[model samples]
Target chain A: MGASGKRPGGRSARVRDAVRQATLGELAEHGYAGLTVERVAERSGVHKTTVYRRWGSVEGLISDALELARDEPWPIPDTGTIQGDLRGIVQLVRSGFADPELGPVSSAFVAAAVQSPEAARALHEFFVARHDQSAEVVRRAIARGDLPDVVDVREVIRVAVAPVYYRLFVAHEPVTEQDADRAADAALAAARAGVL
Target chain B: MGASGKRPGGRSARVRDAVRQATLGELAEHGYAGLTVERVAERSGVHKTTVYRRWGSVEGLISDALELARDEPWPIPDTGTIQGDLRGIVQLVRSGFADPELGPVSSAFVAAAVQSPEAARALHEFFVARHDQSAEVVRRAIARGDLPDVVDVREVIRVAVAPVYYRLFVAHEPVTEQDADRAADAALAAARAGVL
Candidate 1:
């Protein structure tokens, strides 16, 4: 809604903001399994029937929150050097999940997406936006002659951040900041080698 | 049970195998969401009480299956070149997930691990064993001096496979075989650069 300065009119936007906020709060505190439409409605202070009529289910609530998340402004690093920039981007991802407040909500979206096809589609779109935004660093590197134009910019971003997400979600390992930096460096090395 | 030559025992092992197989079947057919002790019991032809006493819950069943899967023989690629072996390992992973029968079960383990702590522990241990096993290729590469001995073997495996998992689970994107090969090569490139 805030992609531009204008809100999508007042009341509807307010209702959506309230519900999305409640959904994030509930997700952060209780996770996807604990999220319920009634609880979200109560927490959001929107009428239960209104929540039901609008969101339909907890899945619907999560989907809407993810769509909203897609529009949220993400600061892409432009730290002059590709090395510093890529590391900054990967570190941002590592720390974002490490943030106690945002971690569970972000994780809940991933957890929900694995179980629900609707959530998966929403999460997919969210990532499409995310990858496009994050690939800016690679584009900048290419433009600056630090990288060749033949490089798969989005794939480089994916390869760079993939390990952090892997350690967090797939391998279930702890991700140190050094580990995040190493992942970025690895992707950088690969890009220079023309592999990614 | 098949890790070594001898089986763990007779009836008890057989019962465990039956229940575990039934658990995988259920997970494959219905996913983590539809997995249930009663359904596993019915499918395994074991008594519901017996299944309950043995498995406790769907989480327990999935945990047990993952534990069983950990010991199943994995053919470590012995291809002469580090590139061939690493690509083989990555391709094994990609093709395994693309297998219609095993894909759903493996995905269900990942899905369950994110939401259930008990399942997470089991999947974590499972990956521990898997990483240890897959790191053999890197170890061999180091031995052959294709890679420096200072490289992080397990992390290379992690990086090589991470993109596949990231595409599958996080980005919800299609992973082509070429994509899988490129991931393996990228990790190899980084390792050669002494960045991994």
Candidate 2:
């Protein structure tokens, strides 16, 4: 497993990973309110001062943990077609609904984002980065003339991914692969019609 | 000025409305966690016994307060065409974003909904009722041959409204009338093509 660069040796990397894992575990159990710097230090077998020095605050630790977990997922796929590319992105969105642990943690983060400016910025950055990755595929499709150059790729990306998040967080509907297919198809249709 | 049927034109009706108003004011001032039934009773001119007798718990009081303020705008207009109908719906969605007082109260309820099963159910029912109102407009369009009869109006309604809530609650995006128009257009196109 990949670990931080701040801690140099293999053993140091393992210690950092342990601390990050404990941070996320505490987050899942206690939410934004109950997660404490002291509790994380105790759980990770690291000194309290060391954890505080490395992370600065609970929000910083939470952000890094999310990044580490998120980076393990598959990269945006380039399938040489807009439909295939969108399908890939939808698959990633659907995966969140399938995982119980990730689902609740993500929900808590969303709630926290509403209240905390730092968390809000982090959440926005995370979505913008993910959308940028998927938008690259649409950019390629435009270059190949499969999609119109005038299409707003960001809007197209939003249309494709927003529904999946809506089903998971708002409606609590089953985010099936079929729902993914429908979302992709509608997004492609909207793009072709110059709505995107 | 609409009062509940439970206590009509009696001293009890005046006390109920006073308590409801005070509850909403407290929610605006302190949010859900900080709000208390005793505070509500003190803020209103009602006795603690009356407040306790009417609403058994804090959750019950919150639900009743929200219900008292519940006024979902009418659905898309009967313009004899989907274009005009969608324009009406989008306008309503836009107005919600402009409401400063309503915004925070609505968000607090959404956050509270995560913990209370009854609140979640009430939220679902509120949305379902809104969806049914919007769906009726789409259904009429199908009857008028502006849209296909095979279209699923329920799904189309979801596509139109979900983005508004997603932007409001999750993304914190300003949901302008233009955004609503685009969403309505996209959903209408999908429905016309029998995609939904």
Candidate 3:
């Protein structure tokens, strides 16, 4: 849907978008532990009663925000070769981690997942959806005889993205372009060895 | 040092041990965002003034707690082969993640690392020290010609550990023993391919 896409019964898409954006900003600033519905309503310029009546709780607000983010258009790259496609995926993830606005929000999501079962479920759903969307890359590679049919597509994708997340969230190390390249190469090497 | 080993001044060591234990307990219960010096002192049974005087801040308390954890003896597995050693390492990590008390405390540390600069630095130091200590596993494998000389030891180790951390922190998925085996196998495959 475009920016102006309408829902059935004429619910305001603009209000939903604004609320989600505000939720992201609040999460990035204060994290899930510090989030307040009043602040979200104020930041979104929506009435406090509306936020309370609709979202009901902070968990509801975060869940909806994650759903909205997951629903946003995320085009998977089609690079013909498995290596190229893996590289494209890694670079895309690297850029997302490097984004100033989105990076902290992403970190907040992880922090929330670590602390709350509800947030953890939401994060898991978001990732599972993204993985499903990206599975076509591996499927195409298998069809082209570049990857074995027995290869686990999700495992390959997870391996390709693991190092980047490891550095960003666990080791607190810098994630450079070279790191992304190495991650993709490592995953490809494992896939070729039939380990994935 | 052994359990009975004492410093030149015995009073400080006992106090430090008590404080660190209390910090871990507090982190396990409330996580980093909910942590407070007052609660730590109360639970530690140490005076608030003493805690304030020594730790000065919650970050300082957490840093010292992490240091103490790092200092604890963690023996590297030696299974006479790269694959065996890797499996041992993965199992060791998996067990740690599965521990009831230590597991939540570990997650709290990660959450702290994401939101605070001091905690991040402490976490980086902890991992770096652990990596340095564990480098001998890869070094022995290379010496035995199980892994190539050109292989990056850190990358191999990072690859082996990445999936476990990714599941625990990012995807919030169950990290089974089978998953750990797969991680070790994938890293070994990549290393054997000279991709690390």
Candidate 4:
């Protein structure tokens, strides 16, 4: 199975996959600042001209790689209660950040996003998609009258994840499962008070 | 005046100030990835050997620059009420991020923190100090019975600032005063509910 759990594709598709994987490897090892098309081409065993012609620049390659990284469908939980749903989502995010392969790649993307406009746009699109995908939980809570209609659904999700990111990127602290639990619970508390 | 608002040192302090200011200017224009010791030396009118001997490496220079950036004492709000104190702090942070001079310099530091371990350590120390400086607000709230005794004071402060940082770095959104108000209110609601 390929990245999407589907059968492998033709030669061109295979080449694209190889290049994307190589791009991620470069990002993990050297970060976005150190990534180069020539290095990616060498690592992927693709011609430099082909890599340059296809991706155009390092930003273009990074954008494509980010899309590929988030290609898998996100699992949105329906645990009957907003607290449970939030806990589930936060746990998933925490685990993703803790993954050795995904952690560095995600960090590199975030670092790149802060420095480059192209990366910023890509990161924004990725998060917006993820937020939209998980909007169902908030909708369900509203239907169940657990939260007021005035509450901002996206704000709740943002609140639930903000502390995790804060600890990871800003404080450079360890984010444990307890921290994830606290994040979910804190958001839930604020939402219940109708502040979110 | 020196960094602490008291002029004590002579030529050495002046040179340090000039070099640190030049480092920040370089970081603001070229970002951490693009910053070079040679450029900093030329910009500061210091010899390359002096720059090298003083800081040793790019990371060392950035670390020193970060220290100088945070050398002054932070203004801790004492607005009597926890809500008032939080609002003051968050508003101060929002304006700092929006300031033309400090804005890009701070973004550069955050970007450098994500990419370099030394920068990350400097960034973490800066925040830890800020958090400690503001701890009195939460302590006052607890004393007044505004929040539960078991509430984690540091967690509340972290929650208050997490949203601002989230919008600034992760979501790549414009952080407004209204957003700052909401962040303070949300953290207050959570603290009131004893989740923080």
Q: What are the runs in model 3 whose C-alpha is more than 4 Å off?
A: A1-8, A28-34, B1-8
For model 2, the DockQ equals 0.42
lDDT of 1 by residue, B98-135 (tens): 99998999999999999999999999999999999999
Tens digits of per-residue lDDT, candidate 3, B1-196, equal 6544555657778889999999999988887878899999998889999999999899889899998888877879998988989888888888987888887788888888876789899999999887777777999999998888998888888889999999888987889999899898999999998788
Question: What is the C-alpha DockQ of each candidate?
Answer: 0.84, 0.42, 0.72, 0.73
Task: List where candidate 1 sits over 4 angstroms from the true fold.
Answer: A1-8, B1-9
Residue A76: error of model 3 in Å?
A: 1.0
Cα error, candidate 1, residue B146 (Å): 0.7
Tens digit of lDDT per residue, candidate 2, span A1-196?
Answer: 4555655687777778988888778867777667788999999999999888988787777776756754554578788788898888888778764667766676667766665556666677676666676799899999998998998887788777777766655555667898887877777787787776
Tens-digit lDDT track of model 2 for B32-126: 76778899989997898889989866777777765664454654578877877876786676675466776556666665665555656665666
DockQ-based class of model 2 = acceptable
Task: Give the Å shift of residue A173 in candidate 4.
Answer: 1.4
True contacts kept of each: 0.82, 0.21, 0.76, 0.72
Model 4: per-residue Cα lDDT over B82-195, one tens digit each: 999998888988898798877877888888888889999998888887787777799899999888899888889999989899888988888888889888988999889878
Candidate 4 residue pairs in clash (backbone atoms < 3 Å): none
Candidate no. 4 TM-score: 0.91
Model 1 lDDT at residue A105: 96
Q: Rate the local accuracy (lDDT) of all candidates.
A: 0.94, 0.73, 0.86, 0.86
Model 3 chain A: lowest-lDDT 10 consecutive positions: A2-11
How displaced is residue B43 in candidate 1, in Å? 1.0
Sort every candidate by DockQ, greatest first: 1, 4, 3, 2
